[model samples]
Target: MDTSRLLRTTGTVLAAAGLLLSGCTTSGSAQRASASAGGATGSGAAHAAPAVPEEPSAALRPYYAQKLRWRECGVPGFECATMKAPLDYAHPSSGQDVELAVARKKATGPGKRLGSLVVNPGGPGGSGIGYLQAYAGIGYPAQVRARYDMVSIDPRGVARSSPVECLTGPRMDAYTQVDQTPDDAAEQAKLVEAFKEFAAGCQERSRRVLPHVSTVEAARDLDLLRGVLGDEKLTYVGASYGTLLGATYADLFPGRAGRLVLDGAMDPTRSAIDLNRDQTAGFETAFRSFARDCAKQAECPLGRGNTDQVAQRLRDFFRTLDAKPVPTGEPARPLGEALATTGVIAALYDESAWPQLREAITQAMDGDGAGLLSLADSYYEREPDGSYANLMYANAAVNCLDQPPAFTGPAAVTAAVPSFEKASPVFGAGFAWASLNCAYWPAKATGTAHRLEAKGAPPIVVVGTTRDPATPYKWAQGLAGQLDSGVLLTYDGDGHTAYGRGSDCIDTAINRYLLEGTTPAAGKKC
Candidate 1:
C-alpha cells in the first residue's frame, strides 16, 4: 500500500456510517471517495528543480484566469463544477487539457465570509469532491464551516476527474489474489507477471491520462482551482498523500500559498524504497499498538501472547492461506494470503477498526474468511457488485510517476528482503514485494527525491501523529524542519491524521489556524 500514500478518505469515520468505504463505493455515487483525508514532512526539489516562475506564464495565465460555472450536484448544498488545466504544464498549448471535477459548500456565514478552504483526503486517487460532500462540509468545526466555503477537487486521473481506468473487475480480482510473498521462482514470476499485467492494463486504457497524473501535475491543478475559485492564494488541508500534494503546491506557488495544513505528511526527500521501508516499520509500530490493546481483551484472537508471538501467529496464518485459500462465502472470490494481508493492513489505518480486524482475523483463523475478505474489498474500493473504483489505478499511476521503482526485478526484491524484514518482521516481506508493483510500470519516472522549502510562502502548519501507522511521526519533524515557515503541531497519539479525529486540543489549535490565520507555536503538542 506504500500507504505512505495512506488511504485517508477510505478510512474516514463518516457521519452516516462508521467508515466512508462502507458507503462511498456504491455505484450510485462515483464522486464519493475522499471524506477520509489522511498524513507530514518538510519536503523537496526533485530533478535540479524547474526555475520558479515569478508569475503565471502567458499560456498558464489563461488557465489561472478561467472561471468555473457552478451547478447543483446530487448532494444538497454542494455545488459541482468542472475546471480546466493543461494536460502538460511544460506545453500548455498542446491542445490537450484536463477537466477537473470540483465541489464546494458555500460558507454559511455568522459574521463574514473568509473565502474557500480546499481539502483533500489523500488518495492521490481519492475523490476530494466526495470528501467535501460526505464530511468536510458537515463534520468540520461549525465556526470554520460557517465562515469558509468547504471545497474539494478531484485531481486529474482521480475519481470524477477523468479517472485512470485499468483492468476490469474480474481481472483485478485475479490480480489481487496473486502471491506477493513468493517462496519459489514460479510464484515470484507469477507475482511479477501480475504487476506487468496491471501496468500494461493501465497503459492500454489510460494512455493519454496516465503520464500526466503525477503529484506535480496534481499540485498544479490545485493552483488552478485557487484561481478559478477567486482565491488570491491557496488555503488547504491535505491528508496522507494529500500532504505531499499540498507541499508540492506550496513549493510550486510560494507567493500564492496561504494557510496550508499538511497532516500525516510524507517526506519528499525519501526515495520510493525508503518510503516503503518507513511505512513498513510504521505499520509494524501500529500493529504492535493494536496488539497491546487486543491482548488485553477477553475476545483477543491471538491470545494473551506478546506482540512477537501474536505477529508470528498472524504470519503463520498467512502462510497457511497461501497454500490453501479459504472460501469467503462468495465461492468465486475466495480469500488468499494477499487478500488477507490487505484486509489486516486496511484495519491498521485507524484504531477504531481494531475490533473489526480482531473479529475478521478470528473468523479467518476459524476457516470462514468472509469477514476478512470484506475488509480487503473495502481497502481495494471494490463495490458490492464486483466493480472497482479507480482508486488503485490512479494510485499506481501517480505513485509510479512520482518516483523511480522500488526494485528493478525479483533479484532486487530478494536482496532487499533482509532490510525490509529488519524494518518490519511481521509484514516486511509482503511490503517488500508489494514495492515491486511499480518496477514494471509503463511510465518512466518523472520525479525524484528532493527537499522542498516553499521559501517565501506564508506560515504553513504541519501536523503529525506520533504513532501513525501509515505515515510515521518523524516525517512531521522532517517536514517542519524543511519548510522555511513550517510550524510543527504534534499529536502524541495514535491513528492517521490529528485534526477532526478526536483530541480537542488538536482540533482547537487547527481551528484557530483555519479560522483566524493563527499559527500554532513553534512546538505545540496535543
Candidate 2:
C-alpha cells in the first residue's frame, strides 16, 4: 500500500523487553544548588555573546531550587524519581503541577564523576526513561557511563509523565486505514472527519495536559531535572526530535548549558509546512538510497529497473492497494494502501531494516499482506491485543502545540501538492495530506518558527547523517550555523541517528565531548 510518510516523525524506537516498570515516587527534599562553571567552552574560544544569568528569575527560581527523592526502580542499577514542574510556567503558584517520570543510572566511577548526562531519543512522544534504561544506560560507551550518571525524563504528556490519550483501539484502527490520498470529495471529507475525531478524542481525554506539552514547556521541565539533581549545568545527548528539546533548553538557559550533543538535528527556523516539505524530500532521498541498494539484491521487490522506474512501480502498487485491499492473514484487518505505506516507510528509518522491507514487500506483492501489516503495526506501536501506546497521541499533541498546522484544510493541502510532489514524486501527496492532521487540533498553537541561537551557551555538538530519512542533514548545517557556539560534527553515514552505531570516528568524537568536555573541531566529518 501507499505508505510514504516516515513514521520516525512520530515515535521513537521501542524499549527492549522488560524495561517498562513503573517508577516508585517519594516526597522531594531540599538540596543546595551547585556552583556554576564559568564559560568553559570545549575549544577554549570566547563566545560571541556574554553568558546569560546563572540564576533564574524570581518566579522560576523555585522550580530550579526544588529537589527530587530518588528510589530504586525495578531495573538493576537504575533509580526512578518524580520531579514537579508548573503546569503553566506563567503562573507557577497556580497550585497545578505535572509529575514528570525520571530515571537514572549512577556512574560506576572508574573516572572522576562528571555529574549527570541526560539522554533523550526523540519522538516528541518517545519514552525518555525507556530509552535511558534500555539503550543509553547499557549501550553507551562504558567509559562515558562510568563517569557521568545517565539520566532521562519522560517529557510531560509522554509515557508515564501524564501521557495524553486519544482514540480507543478499534477507533484508532479505523482511523489508520482512512485514505490519506483523497481522490474525491467524499473521501476528503472522511479524511478530515478522522482528523477531527482524533483531535477531539485527545481534547476530550487529555484537555488538562494537551495545552502544555509543547517543546518549550518540556525544555523547562529539563531545567527542573537539572536543579533537582544538583548539577551545575545541563549535560545532554539528544537524538532526532530530542535535539529540538535540547536546543530549546539551550535557548532558554544558555548560561546553564554544559556539553550538549544534538544528533539528527532539526532546524528550528522552518515553518510547519517547510518542515513537512523538507522531511518529505528527505524521505525521497532515503528511499532512493534504499532503492539503489535493493536493485543490487538477488530478490529485489521493486524489480531491477532504474531507480525512477522502480519508484513508479512501487507507486503503482500503492495505487492498486488503494482501490483493493488484500487479506493480511488477519480476517478483520485487510492490508490497505495507507497501512501498507506506513509499513514501508517504517523500515526506512535504518538500513538494517531494508532486507525486512524487501521481504515484506515481496510477500505483499504475492498477495500475502501479513508481513507488511506487521511492519505498520510496529510503526503505530499497536500491541498484539489491539491496544496502542500513547506515541501517536502524544506526538500529535506536542507537534500541534509546538507550531501551527502546516495546512488549514484539504484545500491548502491541494494547493501545495505540486510543490510537495516535486519534492517527492512517489510519497509527497500522502505526506502533504498527513500534515493536515494538526489543523483540527483542539488547542490554539502555542509556539512559532524561530531560530535557536542559544547564544553564549557552551559549545554544542550537532551531528547529522547524510541520508537520514526524518531530519535531513541540511537542517543540521543550518542549525549549527545559527547557534553562536554550535560545533558541527558530520557523520557521513546513513540512518536516523549517528552515535553508538559502530562508527569509531562518530563515537569517539561524541564520547570525548561527553566525557572530557572536549568538542570536536568544526566541520569534522566521519
Candidate 3:
C-alpha cells in the first residue's frame, strides 16, 4: 500500500529513465508505437462488442440534503455540487456521511447529450473536483465537451470532501524534512519515529475517517455518483492512481461500466513490494532518459558520459545531501534526501517539466538548492506560508487501507536494500525503504489486491505512456489485459498520463472515443 510511497517510487524510476533517454531522439519505431488511430468508428466498433459484468452491487442513495443549485465556478457553464457518501459503504445506514465535492460542465453543442463524462486526476489522493474545475472541465477537446456533461467528484477522505487531516502545519513541516535515506542507526530510528508520529497524528486527528478511506469504498462512491447523475452506465476517465479507482469501479460494478478510460493505469494484482520494486526500475528508466538529454545540453550537471555513470553521480549527490543538507533560503533551508527525492519525483509527472528539473539540478549542483527544494514543496502541495494541503495525509490513509506494508521493520528494509538499489541504481534504495512508512499505519488495511474483470462492461479504453513515471506503462498493459472488454492504447513516449500532456495524436484519439463512443484498437500506440 502506502500509495504515496508507491507513486514516489514509480516517479523516481521513470524520472531517472527519462533523464537518461533525453539525449536520444525518439526512434521511428517508438513513434509508430506511440501513434494510434481515433474517431467515432473506433467507438462504434468497441460498443458492438458483447457486454460483460463480473460483479453487481446495489445503487447508492443521493446524499445531498437538497438538490444542487447549478451555477458557474471557474469555467463557463461549469456547476459544482457537495454530495455525501457513507464513511463506510458496508455501514451506509449509519447516518455518518462523508461529503464528496463534485463539479460539472454541461454539454455545449447542437447534438443531443450522450451522457455524463466523469474524470479523475490520479493521486488516489489527488483532488478530482479541483482538477475538473481547473483543467479537464475546460481543456478537454471541444468535440467531447459538446456531447457529454463533464463531471468530477473528490473521492472520500480527499480534498474539499471531509478530507483526512493528520499533522498540524508545523508537525507536517518536520515530517517532510525527516531524512528518508538513513545512513546510520540513529537516522533509521528517526525515520521510524517519523512514521509512527505520522500514523499517530492521523489516529488522533482523523480517527473516524482513516479506516474507511480505502479505494474500494471510493469506487462504490463513484457508482453512487453515476446513479445520481442519472446515467444508466458509468463513463469515466481516470489517470495514475485514478486508474486504480476506475478499475476497482469496474470490478465492483461491471454491469454498469461504459466507455471507461484508464490512463496511466495501476496494476491491482501487484503486491506492495512488487509495486515498489517495479517503480524503482521505472525511475531508473526515466533517469537514464534525463541523463542522456542532459549530456547533450550546455547546462548538463553530470557531464557527458554513459547514463549509468551519471546515475551513480546523482546517487552520490543524494548521499552528500543526506550527510549535510544544502541551503535553500528558508529557516530550515538545507535540502535533505526526502525533499530532494520529492523534487525529483515531481518532474516525472510530465516530460515538459524535464527542462525545469535540469535547471533545478544545475542550480543544486552549484550549492543553490532553492529551485529543487521549491519543486519538492510544490509536489508535496506545501504552501509558501508554511501551511500544507491534506494530500499527504489522505494519501497515506487511503494507501494504508488498500494493502499491507511491504516491510514491518527497519531490519527488513535493510535486508531489502541491495534489491532496491539494484532495481534502480539511482533511486532504488531510497524508494525501496520509503515503502516501509505504512508498516506503522495506525489503521489496518481493509482491502486486498484483486483482478478487475468487468466482464459485462462496455469496451473500455486503457491508455499508457511507455515511459510513464507514476503509473508505469506495464500497469496500463496489465489493466487492459485484465478487463474483459478492455482495449489498450499505448503512447510510446515519456510522461505520467497521455490525454493532455501535449501529444495531439493522444488528445485526438481520446477525444474521438469520448465524442463518438469509439474505442481505439487494441495495441494501438499513440
Candidate 4:
C-alpha cells in the first residue's frame, strides 16, 4: 500500500498502530498492528530483480567498520546513538553522508548476553526508536529481553533522522478531509490538487533526502548497523512493512542475516496496483470479521443483517456524510466520509479495538462524530497542538521510491476501478484512487516488483494473521514460498500481526527461534 493514499500499521500500539486509506488524499499511516498492537505504514516491493552482490566494495569498507557514538537520551532506560551512512551508496565518494538515529535498552542479565535484537514496527516511515521505547523494549516477553538487547533505528527520511516534511498540520487536516470517494469531476479535481500539493511540498522541503529513502538503501543500513553493533549477523524482529525491510535485508545480505521473524509479511512479487488492490481486499476481509462479531451483539450500531447488507448500509452512511459533515468537538476538524472511513480502517487493524469501533459508529450514527474523529486522530498520530509527526511525509517518500506509482492518473484509476472492486466491493474505488498519489512523486523509483529469494540465508520465520486488514494472509504464504529458507507460521487469528497478541503458540515459536535458534517445522499453524 502506498502510505500516502493508504493509512496503515504494525500490529498497533496495543493503541498506536494502523493507517488510513483515501483516494488522491494525503492519507495518514497504516502502521504495524503489532502482533501485540501496531500496523505497517507503507507497503514495499521490487520488480524484474536487481543484481545484489554478496559484499560491499572496498570504498564502503570504512562505513562497515565505523563505530557508533552512544549517549543517554531523554528516554529513561534507553540510550541513543548515531551512525554515518553514505547519502548515496552507489556513490561513496560524493563526500556526503546521512546520520541515522538509533536507540537501545541493554539486556536484563541472568543469562549470557546474546547479540542485539533489532526490531522495526513498520511504516516504511515509522520511527523504530519510538516503537522500541513505547512497546518492544518493555512489552516483549521477559525471557527474551533477559538475553538480548532491544535495539532500533529511525530509517533515513523518517523521524529523528533527516525527515521528509510536506504539509503543515492545518494543511494536512484539510487534505485528509478531502472527499476521497469522488462523485464527479469537481470532486476528483479537488482530490488531485491535494495530491499535487503534497508531492510538491515534499520536493520543495525534502528534495535532498527524499530520493535516497528506498527500502534497499534502508536494508543496506541494517547491514552497516550489524557491523557497528559488533554482531556477526543481524538478529531481528520486524512487523508489517518492517517485514518487507527484513525480507529485503535477508535477500541482500543473506550471509549476514541472522535469526529473522517477519510477521504480517508483504509479498515482494506483486505490482504496485496489485498491492493496493490486495490491501483493499484485506481491509474488506477484516470488516467482514468485525461484522460477524457485531451481528451477535445487541449493541451493534450497524444494526443486524448479514455482512453484505451491513456493508451496504455503511456505504450509505458514508454517502450521507459526503453530503453533510458532522461535528467532531474541534471546530475545524469535522467527521466526514474520509475521516470516518479512516477511523474504521484504523480499528480494523486490531480486533481488540472493535468495541471502540462499535461505540464510535453508534455515536456517529447519533450525530456526535467525536468518537470516530478521535479514532481518526489516533490513526493519523495527530498531537493535541495540531502539529503532526513526520510519519505521513516519510511514508509517501519511501513508498513512492520503493515502487512505481500504482496508477498514473485519474484516467488510469477509472480504468482500474472494476478490477479493484472485483477484489473488494467496499473499498475498491477509494483505494484505486488512493494508489494515484505516487504518480505525482518527484523521485524516480529505485526498486521494482520482484522476488526476494534470500537464497543463502538461515531459516527465516514468517508469521501471518488469517484476517489481517493491511497485509493479506496470502502475502505471508507467498513470501514464505519465495525464500529458500522461509518458514510459514500461521495464526488463525484476527489483527494485523501474529506475535505478542496473546497467542502463546505464535510467541513461543518466535521466542524459540530467537533464543535457542529452533526453527518451527515448515507450515506450522498456531
Distance (Å) between predicted and true CA of 331, model 2? Answer: 2.4
TM-scores of the candidates are 0.93, 0.91, 0.88, 0.92
Q: Who is ahead in lDDT, 2 or 3? A: 2
TM-score leader: 1
The best candidate in terms of lDDT: 4
Off by over 4 Å in 1: 1-51
Q: Give me the overall lDDT of model 2.
A: 0.78
**Candidate 4 worst ten-residue window by lDDT:** 27-36
Superposed on all Cα atoms, model 3 deviates from the true structure by an RMSD in Å of 8.9
How are the candidates ranked when ordered by TM-score, highest leading? 1, 4, 2, 3
Off by over 4 Å in 4: 1-55
Model 3 C-alpha lDDT per residue in residues 422-476, reported as the tens digit of each score? 8787777778667888899988764445566767778888988888766678877
**Residue 40 of model 2, lDDT score:** 18
* lDDT by candidate, in order shown: 0.79, 0.78, 0.71, 0.79
Angstrom error of the Cα, residue 409, model 4: value is 0.8
lDDT of 2 by residue, 135-210 (tens): 7898889999999999999989998999999999999999989999899899999999999999999999999988
